[model samples]
Target: MFASVFVIALGLCYCSRASSQSSLGLPRLFGPSEALVKTAIEMNCELLTFPEDEPILLQLFREGNHSRLFAEYTSLEGEVADLPVYVQPYHEGNLECVARAQNNSLIEPTVSNIHYLKVIEPVKGAEIEVRSGSVDLFEGNMLELRCKLKAGNHVSYKWLLNGRLVSQSLLHDDRLLINRTTSQDSGSYRCVASNSFNQTDFFTSNSTEVVITVREPVKGAEIEVRSGSVDLFEGNMLELRCKLKAGNHVSYKWLLNGQLVSQSLLHDDRLLINRTTSQDSGSYRCVASNSFNQTDFFTSNSTEVVITVREPVKGAEIEVRSGSVDLFEGNMLELRCKLKAGNHVSYKWLLNGQLVSQSLLHDDRLLINRTTSQDSGSYRCVASNSFNQTDFFTSNSTEVVITVRDLVSTPNISFTVLKEDFQNYSAVVTCRSTRGTPPVTFSLYNSTEVIASVTVEEQFATFKVPLILGQDLGFLQCQARNGDNATYSEKIPLEVVPVGGPVKMPYTYDSGENYDVIGVTFYCKAEKGTHPRYQWFLNGTLLDDRGSFYYVDHQPPEMAMLMLSVGDSSAGTYHCEVSDSFDNTTAISSRRLYLDKHTLNRLPVWVVAVVFGSFTFLILLVSVCCGLGVVFRRRHYGEKSLLDFEMERMTPVYYGKLDLSHYNEDTDVVNAARWGEVDQASLDSVDEWPQIEEEKKTLEDEPAEEP
Candidate 1:
């Protein structure tokens, strides 16, 4: 091992382009062969000292850490410890540390094994050198970039094109090689040199950039949309760029449907169409070319990319597949929305102006598995597309009314007797259904035979038929049908009532002693009858006038009542005549009703006169009291004097009733001041007054009674 290491070191020294500096006194060094720059390193020799002997005069030395030749650096005496070696531009040379004896001829100087010091400096000053003077490259030519360093050691090279590390296949020891290059290889190229001084952290340096322009015939050309998609809608902006996989200094031309588009429609290499319309939709491509000479150019056509421009949806209308507005219960319903013009449309259903069930909104046609009454409503459809993310381009279909009806429910039958003869009876039979559509047909059945049928817009239908007495209107049934379903009422039997009786009055009539009775009810009924009619007679005359005199409340198959409002002439004979409406047979009451006279008491003339006179005297007395009270109130509570009251009493000036010419205004004011009862302004405020002396004469003619 020692001999081989020595031989290897000697060969390395010879192989080095630059010579290494060595310390002549030091022997072969024994230490680590590799180290970091500016980091301490140790070199020692195998020299020892005994307790009984003097320490050997050993020292350490280092060289070849600098670029200068024959440059040697040494350590102090007895400095046989670890020798730290610092590096400069030059590194990776030999280091020697020698140990010698104090005094002994037999003990020669000790020499250590060769210590090869390899100082790894941080990489710096990295620059890429293009082998070709100018990087104006052509297709099918080789690309070469040499990474050089101004000051670094043990560095590895990496090539980056456009700031990305190049493939390892093109890297060869501080150089990048690309043979038969294409336009894709043309970009800013840089070389990175890196080395680790401590094997833990790597120091890296990037080279100056070099750009290569590789010109070639345009190939693998294509058009790309700036929005990453070629689909567009009306009013949308379209921007398409021509891209070439292998080309340089190329000009672009756009083509639509194999037709060359004008250059005015293009912006540089891009074709821009603002507010794209349906007319702009077609197969689009681009041709790329480069002119090498004034008249020579290489051209290539790109692959076509079909573009689709959609039109906004509009004028939506709903159509019912069943072709009818009304639908039966449990029927399948289908409705579709049709558009006037649109593309790529999606539809949704709205029922009664609200969005329908989410589980049914999957397609243009709304399909129902089974329809019910709950599904009856106004139906509409909305059409939209991806053109409007906010649904502004959406349209609503015109409303289509849909009516889902239920099957006709069980019919209900009833009978009402209109009239009847001695043998045949006329009756109205009605049939109805609670749940059904209108325009229902109802049939009346007697013993499984149709007696009558009637169709009406209402849910119910009525039929009038004649029945024979003592015969079966047998098992009367009513069937109601509306559209697809029919329902029947339960079978019923009809019975005929005959007129048999000695008719009698069951209830009593009371007119009592009260002369002022509002009404008196007289009731009469037969022993047995069918729909009996009654007539009331007063003094042998039929009381047909149902005016204020009487009201006849009669219920067939029951009793008939006569309510008489007592009037001056309502006192006389009263009787009820009962007759069967079915047979025209009549019967009279068993006994007649005699109503006593309800006469009002008469008053004497003298008594009426006394009452009238007493009322008039009382009214006059009250009026006189009211006037006197008002005068007293004005004299006390009001701000008026007694003279003012006297003046008011004497004044009667309307239509010149009072003759005020005999009175003087001045005499009135003098009298007011002398009395001290009225102010002059109060006396003057009175418009007129009766003659005072004449009024005094009239008062004197009246008798003066006690106060």
Candidate 2:
């Protein structure tokens, strides 16, 4: 019995130990099978194999595969190994499996919580750019691509063309070079930097493009002429174009048939000869080159142009028909240009040698109205036919010297108003020719006779006279005379009047009578004058120009009133004044004006309207609410039985109670008739009517008030 007990006790102890080792509840395989141990290690299981059994035992590794990114796994050793402070163990053939978190990406479990292992997937942030030495791309240019602003280990650069892999670095390099670019190389390119652990799991940069254009190298070039209708006429405009259609870095030159023309005389592939005459008839062509490449150009000469000239006009000379004359500044002169011999001729006038006027009066005459000293020049008239417009020809005209001598201008009269009023004012008059000869004589005259006279070698003269203010001013003027001519000024009209303004109103604001409320009523007055202005003063201080309560007058400005709308603050002793700067004078009121404060604050129209409207609305709302309350309670009482409705004690319980105890079926008709208040109509012909019992409705204390 003792031996059997011992065996049973031993089996129980062995079972407990085995259960603790088999964490996944699987039976532990105690055999050291090589295949099982290798497979478990490959799947990232933490295996505790004997040092002599492991290949070298110098390093401990979590289960993983070897790759180009193996170097990066070392940098995560400390972080991943420090986590998942617990492990579950199992036996797999020759190895024991210890399962724990192999990466740092995990929620740390509490002591009472079940722990878990989470594997972190590798990720990288990447960007790309062109290499610094790479300029804008062109054919035959060297180009490079670089991966920049990236974070990852074991990163490899890949360049794609049109979404397909084109250029790749040999090692873990981040740059790719293109030896030379061709037109066929132009494409949408993309550079990608990857962690290399997973190629498809990558970030792609923005697309960078390469544009390649072909520029042909320079060779020999030729010139061509494309002038249509070069059969030359005297006035025909011609052109010769030297063209080089094929070459890089090309240059051009122009030539006259076989003569090499200086480049200084030509403007880029053109040679222009204006007003071509008999001397201009020649063979013309241009020479072309690619001087930028230092290459001489070739020319095909069958395209030469020979020009022939002709004359369609005869004897186009100009003659001066009018002799020159000396004249005063204000005097007029006419100069004429006559065509000596030409058909269908036109005329132009010249001062010295420069062309002056192309449009002229009838008979080619130039009129100088109010001629000035600047008009004194050598005048000539030019005669030309239409044929001479484009063909070169010498314009012929004899010069004429226009001698403008000792010129006198019209007189201008200015005045200063002196004292005196009513009908006339004492004033001084200045008469002068603004531009004239020095020895000028000015005579001041009225309609009847000359009032004053002065002869001075200066530009102006003055005289004093008592002038009338009205119609007589139009009768005075001045006349000025030089050696050759005399001139009279337009009449001078003098306006003279005494300055005036309002002195006082017949009534004063001091009157105790309440005549008007603020600006509601006002006294009307029209301040009439020539250019009248006004100023107002209140309480010995100038008021601001305008304010909220000031009156707006639809009438003219001078006919408006000065308003005191709300007079409490505005009321004061006031003065009215005006000043005229024409004669530098001022006018003030003869007597003082006064305003007094009213008994109450004047309400604006809008405020009064708002107050009245609100009171009316509130009265209407209260009346509507009270009437509606009675109507609704009566309706509710009629819909319910005498005892069905609930009522508070303070409210009369009898108010909603319908007294139906005395009701009878036959009395319905009689009740309706009495309730309708029917009046009896006379039935004269009828003798007997149906005898009906009347319903009596006695007023008992006007009934109890309802609701």
Candidate 3:
């Protein structure tokens, strides 16, 4: 080993490129080779201490700490460099160690030819880790295991599977890299790092073994959405089951168009839609995951379950895709039907409220192959479909106007200067036709008549108009006429901002309530003309700049801020006048400041008296009505009781009277008259009337006749 290392070091000693600065003394001991020194010294990176009494094997190593950059390194003299040599810690099998010759310039550093080798050994830690392989493995997967410590001189690596020496030709090196691992490799694996000081003396480290398990791939993973629903109309419930034929150790998730379904929409292995709406129409999928035999979670998705939720088509909106009502003749046009929240199956096209052929409605878009002037009418789109096979739904219709122009392409309009002035202001509106067939005429029109016209053979035309006599011009238009196909662009309102006028600033309009005391400031600006003046007056009296309660502050650019503490005396009409010294013209605007006065419950005598009198009258009327009602009720009940008693007494007495049914006609009539006419007041008097004389005479005279 020493002879081969010496030969390799000699072969690698030649310096590749000369350094910009003079290098140190001849590449000697205690440092790297001449090639490595040439690269490292220019980069200003220090050289680490070499192991004493060992052959210069030039081992390439990496810091085991997994960070963005392993920025820590120790030199022979315990020095460090700012620019660290970067290395990948995870990929460890074969690495190319390159030394970059860096300088203090911003340019890229020149890199040296990289020397390659296997990663050095790790330190003796008490555990085993997968340095270059996954922690968990499956059948038919390649795996590599590494010892935590690298082998030194007289050191060796031995791998054991469940405490038994694994016998394989591929385990010659210190690495335990395996390809297509199977269940035979699944055991308690540990790396036995043995160090030998002499031929007879050796030692081994106590490393905790790592267990590896392998599982077979799932068989035929799929999902099925079984539905028993037919009446899937609005307000109806929809039921579906996400059936899977995967392993039992799988976790399920319901996804609606790649988005995880909300908790309310998922119930265990089923998707239960409580109420179906128009928005629920989409593709659904079932995703499952299994992590038993893998390092990270592995997932599989089922096929999409397409569903259509239906509702009544209530309304629709029409959108002209070309964004123009007036289209050039012999051009393609498109109109879209923006349907409301509904599930529609078919559509019908209409022209001027009359139904057109169903063939005209194509792809939710009404495409006019070649529009002509005859097709200039109101076009309507009627969407018709049913929520279900058995139920019927109302169709929605929307209309828009489409005027197919017979004379030109739409013109491009722009104004050079759009400004208004009471004096003289000239502006121009230019019309350009870059795509139209030219020999076109451009016309600028006001509200009523065409005011300016220009015929141009070129692709552009301009029309100049005066803003005098009327600064308020209506919407201006430009028409480009070519042959019999002329069309004007959309109307452009020529809004000219006023150049100079009486200055106006936004102000507050708040009405003060009673008992409110506030200090408000009013501002008047006059920057229109030179040498302007500002004045403020309250109720026809000029307020002087006297006290703190009433003061005026003059500011830059011709503005005055009048501050006033408004109270009862300050509540009056105020006017602010601004005058232009150059034009001798003044503009005045007035505002009223009124603070309501507080009153202490003052009411009119007549109103109070009328209210009190009305209340008293209402009380008396209610009391009298209650008393009369009670008295009337009592009298009515008393009379009813007397009548009932009289009827009951007469019933018994009449039955005890003589038998009047056997009487003759004359006698019956006479007896009935006598009985009915008998006075109720004389009934008690008849028994006591002249009783003594009649009884005595009857007894003596009729003694013989009695036998």
lDDT of 3 by residue, 528-584 (tens): 533345667777677776554668776633677777664445555555666532222
Better of 2 and 3 by TM-score: 2
TM-score for candidate 2, residues paired by index: 0.32
Candidate 1, residues 429-477: lDDT per residue as tens digits? 7787898877788888987899888888788888877766545656789
lDDT, candidate 3, equals 0.53
- lDDT of each model, Cα atoms only? 0.65, 0.46, 0.53
Better of 2 and 3 by lDDT: 3
Give the candidate order by descending TM-score: 1, 2, 3
Off by over 4 Å in 2: 1-321, 325-395, 398-443, 451-475, 478-495, 501-576, 582-585, 589-614, 617-621, 624-707
Model 1: number of backbone collisions: 0
TM-score of each: 0.35, 0.32, 0.20
Q: Evaluated with TM-score, which candidate comes out highest?
A: 1
- Please write out the lDDT profile of model 2 over residues 1-707, one tens digit for every residue: 43444433432222111112211111111221222111221212222321110111011222232121111111111112111111112211122222222222231211111112222123245545666353334346666666664343434567777787874442237665666666455556666665422234443344345432323333333343333444444433345555544433335555565777656556566555433456556776654544311333333333456666554333433433444466656567777665545656567677776777545355567776666777778886656555435553234466777766666778888776654654445767888787876788888887657999888989789888885543245466888987757788878655544446454433212222333333322223324333234455666765455666554232323433456564546555555454332343655443444433322222334766898798667656655665665566557568664223322111211111112333334554443211111112211111211211111112222354332
